[model samples]
Target: MIVLDYPYVSRFLTDSVLELGQAVLDTPQARRLAGDAPLHYIDEIEFSARLALGGKVYTNSENGLGHVLRCRCNEDLARQIDICKDKALFRESVAALHPDYRFRRVPFEDLAGLDAPDVDYPFIIKPTRGFFSLGVHVVNTPADWPAAVRAIEAERAALNAEYPEAVVSGGEFIIEQSIDGEEYAIDVYFDAEGNPVITNILHHTFLSADDVSDRLYYTSARIIETWLLPFTDYLRDVARECGFRDFVSHIEVRVTETGDIIPIEANPLRLAGWCVADITALAWGFNPYECYFKELRPDWDAILTENQGMATAMVIGDLPSSLDRTRIRDVDYEGFQSLFANILELRKIDYHQYPVFAFAFVSLPETELPALKQTVSQDFTRFVVTE
Candidate 1:
């Protein structure tokens, strides 16, 4: 039995093992939709999650206490790091493992002024409990500090109106010295015994240093080819150090040129947003969601032995524009495909909470990245949206 949170389920991914006769989906929405035979009903979200995920299950939480408590059928340990959800708290965990880690917290209202006078430049300031990169600022210099603060404040104001319940509204954000090197996003599931089973390791291609928007943010599974061993080892050590077991984490880290591992943060929740989480399926033959439910550990040696070609996932939206929610009303499907190729799967939908023209791209290396990125730019440019 798998517990599915109604709110987290996506519309594009449906018809999965859970939706089929493979596994039972337990959720409030599923129960409600079942009507007279509530036990037999399934949630619409499970399908969208499947369509995007290519049939993976959404299970596990980093620190989802409410979710763990809601249904007795769910995993209770998912909330092992409830306090760790806050960036400051998680930083403590990371710092404990690595003494070189550095971070501090400042009130959201003081972000512009940054009450800490000695705080150096070229740092990152983000909500203690933030998601989707909202209110995230990278201050490169003293001059950039004011603008960063203003940008964060403006974003906080907008979020106050739109996402009032966000943890950012709680008043504090964390600051940390920016680590130098390649940034990678790792999606993994820990078995009951605390062994981490990695689903995917993505190499992040950002638009710019200060671009907080997820738009133009691209991650390719191709990275798994070179640095998988080192990253997997790092995450395993992090999980053990943080005392995480029976959970899933989507952690971001910086791999220095010399191979030093620095964790940015681990949002110990499921991986990715929308169907982006499912990109693991394209990277590997199995679905990441299924890994959690089935408690499957990736047999890297065997899987890699059989797999051919590489998969890349790219996110294109109104990035490099504004953090303000961009409402998309129209999408040029044909036009979008015309620009890019090797498109394994693409799902364009209105992410109500984020409110932007967001789509997940699972592409094969049949086409070069430069050509693919050019098409992605055109798709985002022409995609109709209320910016």
Candidate 2:
């Protein structure tokens, strides 16, 4: 069973759900978004009953988590969500895995009272329950704390009404020591026996050290080939540690200089939020959603042979923060797409309803990686025409 809710659902996901004959939980939002799409609707009662019978449930967005938590009959599943959603709790849960890791959880009201003099430099501070990169900031020095606090305050006020507490809570924040190395995001599920099944692996790239925006993510056969086996092993350990079974997660991790894999956080019961997982389909010719429902794994050797040296990317077209969205008249999507050599799909979002303008998927060769890097650094304000 799949539960669909805001902020965005890709056409690829909706079609895949229908193609796999998965029942979408009947909700007004689902109905409205999937108009005339012939989706199999399952009422709350039946869905809850299926949950009691250990039926697997996958949610596309964390916004759908509230509904799933209310309807779910499995306490274990709820527990898993609790651990993954709360960044502080997630850190504590996995602390045994990395005993040397340092972290502290602070209440939202107590943020101002935090003593910067005693604090360690080069740490990350973010809402305990956060989605995307909202409220995430890196404090590299004592001087950065005041600015970070101010940013968090602004974010607290701006985001409180924008998302559900289940999605982005402002009640508490976590301060953790930064992990060094290359970051990657994975879409994987723990099967009935608790074995990890990795469906997609994306290298989360950033232009600079302080750039925490979710502007770009891409995947290629080379990325999968290098990290698949090690990540699978690490996730296996994580699943066992967390007591996870028949659960899906979008996990972020940093592979250290010494080749140690340290988890950042695990987003439970979904692939990458906002259908970024579709890059798997665009790159490897398989549906990520269907892979979980049907228990299918791609033959990596064969897939790599077919998709050598190709990179598929998901670029977020975020509106410039300084631009007044309320006064926006038009978005130059054509000019934006002109930046890319080959766009596989462009999913334009309603900027009036959401902060982003679109989610673009592009296909690139390994030699063209510089283009992806260059695209992320582009100023999005140039694409907006405000009244």
Best by lDDT: 2
The TM-score, computed over Cα atoms with residue i paired to residue i, of candidate 2 is 0.98
User: What C-alpha lDDT values do all the predictions have?
Assistant: 0.59, 0.88
lDDT tens string, model 2, 1-387?
989888878788889888988999999988877778889999999999998888888988898898778965889899999999998888888888998888898998998888773546798998999988888889999888888898888878776566788899888989988887999999998898889999999999988988888898989889999999999999998888888888999999999999999999999899999878888888899888888988888788998999899999989999756667899899999998888989999988999777899888999998898867987798987898889
lDDT of 2 at 229: 99
lDDT of 2: 0.88
RMSD of each: 5.9, 1.2
lDDT of 2 at 201: 94
- Please, what are the lDDT tens digits per residue for candidate 1 over residues 1-387? 333333334432344433434433555544442333423334445533442333333343222234333332323343443544677877776676678666787887676555433556678888887766766778787776777776776676665443334323548888888777878878877766667777887777665565455554344434666767887778778777777776677888888888898887776556765446766666666766666767777787777665545546665554333433445445556666555555666665444444544465656563466655555544354544444
Once fitted onto the true fold, the runs of candidate 1 whose alpha carbons sit more than 4 angstroms away are 1-8, 11-13, 17-65, 69-79, 112-117, 160-170, 216-222, 319-329, 351-353, 374-379, 385-387
> How far in Å is the alpha carbon of 61 misplaced in model 1?
8.9
Q: Estimate each model's TM-score.
A: 0.79, 0.98
